[model samples]
Every structure is written in C-alpha cells, then in structure tokens.
Target: MAELQDELTATAEMGELAELSSPTEEPPAPPAPPAGDALTRARALLTTHPVADGYCGLPATLRTLPWYDLELGDSSVDTDIPRLRDGGVSALLWTLRLLPGTAHAENPVTAVLEQLDLAKHVVAEYPEGLRLARSASEACDARAYGRIAVLMGPAPAAAIGDSLATLRALHTLGLRVLTLSGASWATEAGLTRFGEEVVREMNRLGVLADLTGASARTARRVLAVTKAPVILTHSGAHALNSHPDNVPDDLLVDLAAAGGVCLVPCSAERTGSALGDVADHLDHVRRVAGPESVGLCGAYDTGAVHPDGLADVSRYPYLIAELVERGWPESDLAQLTWGNVQRVLRETEFAARAAALRRPPSTARIERLDT
Candidate 1:
C-alpha cells in the first residue's frame, strides 16, 4: 500500500514538473494536412498512369443542338469535362442517348444511329481534346496524345434486340461496351436462350459487356457465357449494405474467377454521400475479391448526389490519394485505375476477331419469359 501511494505521488510530481517546463517545448507540430491534401503526392502519381472511368452518365439533352458546344470551364454544365482531364482521366465509357424505352421508339435502329451521330459530332468538334476510341490500343494512343478517349456505348442488352446484325453494326459504329441491363428489370435464374445468344454476339463483336444494373441471376448467367472478361461498371458490395444495387460477395467471387472486374460505384445512394463510404466499398471489395478484381466507375453527371469530397470528376485525385493514405500500394492503385480494365478491353478485341472467324451467328430463337 505504501509503495503504491509513493508511486502515485512520484508520477504526479513528475507530471507537474513536465507541465512547468512545457513553455519551452516546441510549438505543437503544425496541424496535419487536410484529408485531400494528404494525398497530394498520390494524386500526382496518377499522371503517369492511364486512368479510366468504367461508366459515366450523360445529360438528358445529349442529343439536343449544341450541347457539346458548352465551354470546358462552364460550371453551369453538369460535368466539367476539362476538369476530368486535369484529374488524369484518359478514357471513359460514355452512355449513349437513347429514346425512352426499347419498344416505344418509332424507328429504334435510327435512334441508335442518331446517338452514334452525336458521338461523332462531339469528337469532330473537339478534335484536339477528344476522339472516339474503338479499341483498347486506340485508348492508349489517346492517352499518349494527351486527349480524352471516348468509348461510346449503351445500357441494357435489350436495346440491341435479337439481331446479331445490329450487334455487329453497332460495333462498327464505335460502340465498344454494352451495359447488360439498361435499367431495373426482373430477375431470372440465367439468361434466356435469346439472352445467351446476345452474349455470344457481344463476345464475337468485341463489345465489352457490363452488368451494371443487371439482376444477380442474369449476371451469373452472363458470366457463365461471356468468353471475355465482363465488368460490373458501377456496383457496390451487397454484403456491406444489402442495397438492391449492390452486388453480393458470392457474385463478386464468381466475377473475379471469371476474370471480370467489379468497378465500385460512387453513387451516394449506395455508398452514402461521404468519401469514407466510397473508401469503405473499395476496401470491402478488395478484402472480398482482391484489389486486382476491383476498379472504379464514377457515375458523374448521372444526377445522383455525390459525396462532398467527390462532387465532380476533378476530385478523383482526392479519392486515389485517400486510398494511398490507407496504405494501398501504387501497383494496386494502377489496377484499380486502369490496368485491369485495360487488359480486359485488349483481350476482348482479340476474342472478337477469333469469334468472327470461327463462331457462327447464334441460331437460337428468342425464348420469351412472359409467355
């Protein structure tokens, strides 16, 4: 008891002596950099890497006259394209402007053609800053030339209908990617005979298939049939939050095994309106299916609320920097940024050529589910 009391008294006396001498101590270390600033060096590293946005939405007025004429510095515009380039984004999958529904259009094929025309018009208008990339190598060329490579695509396989000829035509029209389900739809065990044929054609035509808004079952079936690596361009880990939009861990594992990448969606509705939530989704996918299996798809200009720290495309540097601060090595960050998806894109091109030579157009008829 005496020893304990003496020890306490000695600690108290020492504390008091230290406090008295504290005036001579150096000023407390300057406050640490703001969260974003801490990642400054990491952001700089992005310049040397080819950063790609797996999915990016566009305004409803995409086809309106002179929409592409908006100046780069125009903050009034929903997406600051110049800002995206400054942040080191070299390639992006820009969605095609389609009519309301697949079946409601007067001439669906013409609608598709019009969307392609808009894409070409933008590239022509901004020749120095943008170009349409039809292959992975073209994207790399755009990066070397300091231009943003725009890869035009559409959502939902339904838009192409059951026409293999349309799939081939779209590929020739500069359509390089197709989001599996354009919007929310019913879930099924797997692809219908018609859907399976669609995958076969996509694999043959060199169009990258994205299961962004697809149901879990449909994703599995597509994964099973797609000969090339697939992508879930903008999805979250369901195990973390169980949001309908989030992909479950089992599917993630399957996706990785099938050589596909799951690009973490930056939607506030799924990851919350905080940068930390975005990091959480990234970390969870990394933990569940390795960092190589994960990538990013910032759905900018989609009208979805964004995290304060990531309000626009210019803020990508902060996100990359945050991951670095959390001890993510540069190599892993490369895969998350562009390496993995680049490889997938390149391989899809090769697979397409092979399929065109040896694989015949699927003779399978459309198998109706509603029937």
Candidate 2:
C-alpha cells in the first residue's frame, strides 16, 4: 500500500499530474463506423444469436447492445469474453455501461437488449439508466435502448439521501443488485456505521450489495457491516492482475467468506486480455473461495474496441483454450461460463420473478426490439 502511495505521490509531485484531453489527446475519432468489407468482417466475427425454443430467454438485465466498443478503439475493455467462450463460459454476468463513473459508462443496457445478438450479460445502472429501465421494453420498440441487466449500484448507504425512496424506485424498476459504488471511490452507503444500516435495509428489500470499484478502505469497512452476500461485479483478483481496479486475492477470498460473490470482469483494467490474466483471477478465486463464490462481471467494450492486444469480443474464446491447455476441469469451466453467475442471479428474488415472467417474443416482455 505504501509502495503504491509513494509511486502516485512521486508521479504527482514531479509535475506529471494527468492533464485533461487537449483537443489532440482526445480519443481518436472512431474510424467511420467500419464500412464496406471492414464492417462486414467485424460483423461476421461478432454475430449474435437469439435464444432457441426451450432455451431459457435471457433475463431482462443480461442483454447487450449490438455495437461492440473495441471496434471504436478503447483502452480499458478486456478480450476475455471471446477467449473465455472458446471452451464455453457458464453464463454471462453483464455489468454493461462499464463503471468509470456516471459519465464514463458506455454501452447502455437497452443497446444490448435490442442488439448484440451473440451472448448476454447483466448490467450496472446509473441515474439516467434507472430512469430508462422503467420503460425499456416500450422504448426499444420505438427503436431505442436494447436494455439489459441493471448492475444496480446503491450509493454506499452513506450516500443515499432517501434510502427508502431510492430502493422503492429500484424495486419498482426490477433492479436485483446494488454494488454501492463505482470503482475507486467511496459512497455514503460505504461509510462506516451508517452503511451497515443501509445494508440491512437493502437486504430486506432483496438488493445484493456490489463491492467492486470500491476503495480498498471501503471494501474492508463495508464487508464488515453488510449481512447479505456482496458482489464485486466486473472485477479481477488483484494478486495476479495487480491493478488498482482489481480486488486483491486475499480480499476476494474475504468477500467470499463474507458470503459475497466476486465477479471477474473481463476488461483491460486488470489482465489486459491475456489468457493468463483471466485464468489467474479465476484460479485465485477458486482456490480461496471455492466454486460457489466466483463469477464473471464482464465489462467488455466490443463497441470502442481496444488496440491489437485485447481488442474485440471475437477474441473471447481464446481464454477458454488456455484454460483447457492448462487442463482445467470441465466443471470449473462450467462455473465460470455461466453456472456461478446463474446461481447468484437465480438465488436473488429478482431473477426468480423474471424467470416466472413471459419470455415469449409475442409475450409482453418482448416489445419490438429497438432497432
């Protein structure tokens, strides 16, 4: 910890503090939406499939948009989904819109529900997103948001001004989990004593607490207070990936011990799409928390698309191949792919209710998919 602090302090004091994007430093404009053969090639690779008859339809919260961000060129998204899918991922734990902040989120849930035909994931929500969820089915029919899971995060209990009202709104909108904060910062809900009271309230209302993107201090404090299993949605075990965004392996195990599930998000923030990086987090979690505790909270940006390294979701399968080569057990693979996340979601009241709801295309839940 001291080492990291020193590194940061030295960097800051050296007058190397970060600068806002000057006109030139700005994200290079997206190359003309990948036209002609390039567009065709990209589409061919990222093709999505609809659910087959008898196959359970994706939960409303798990859909992703048709556009993949990596194609646009982003640095933070990971290549794990393509790689992990190679052998077979158990289930998709989508925390779409990513979680840099309310402002930094990308790929809205509605986008996924309407497009992104390949796979599905759960979503994290922002204030605007919450409002959108209220009528995603209707909006999409008009060719708007695709809509998916609300990786619903509660401002740390410390943060929520009107807990009862906020949760009531979330429940009305069908939000399942609330992570409490975005990455790195602490919220009021994550505050010391008062936070616990909020957790109690969330638990009563059936909201799971998400601990990912939480300050390390917040992690230490929040876990001590909450009663329900917390989720570190879309995160990596730090021991291996070693990024600030990742939870340390020891901490991940502690989260599991506290009965929380740690979601290994497949983004560049941690392993940068190295098959080894993906495997390392999964392995660490499995070794410590056992199978029941870990799952993927994928935050891939097939839209903005990273550089050559972790790039597109087309590369998702590569991770699976690496796991297989290492002789990973098939059962374990199942857990990572879908089993773990499924268990987590299903156990939640929201999933159970959603499962009972109509999935038939003509059924009410299926509004005309937004264009």
Best by lDDT: 1
TM-score of each: 0.83, 0.53
Per-residue alpha-carbon lDDT of candidate 2 for residues 247-315, written as tens digits (9 for 90 to 100): 776786687777667766556556455546666777788787877777654454323223233344444
Compute the lDDT of residue 341 as modeled in candidate 2. Answer: 52
| True-structure RMSD, every candidate | 9.7, 23.4
TM-score of candidate 2 to 2 decimals: 0.53
Q: Each prediction's Cα lDDT score?
A: 0.76, 0.46
Cα lDDT tens digits, model 1, 180-201, are: 7742232445566667777888
Model 2, runs deviating above 4 Å: 1-162, 182-190, 302-310, 350-371
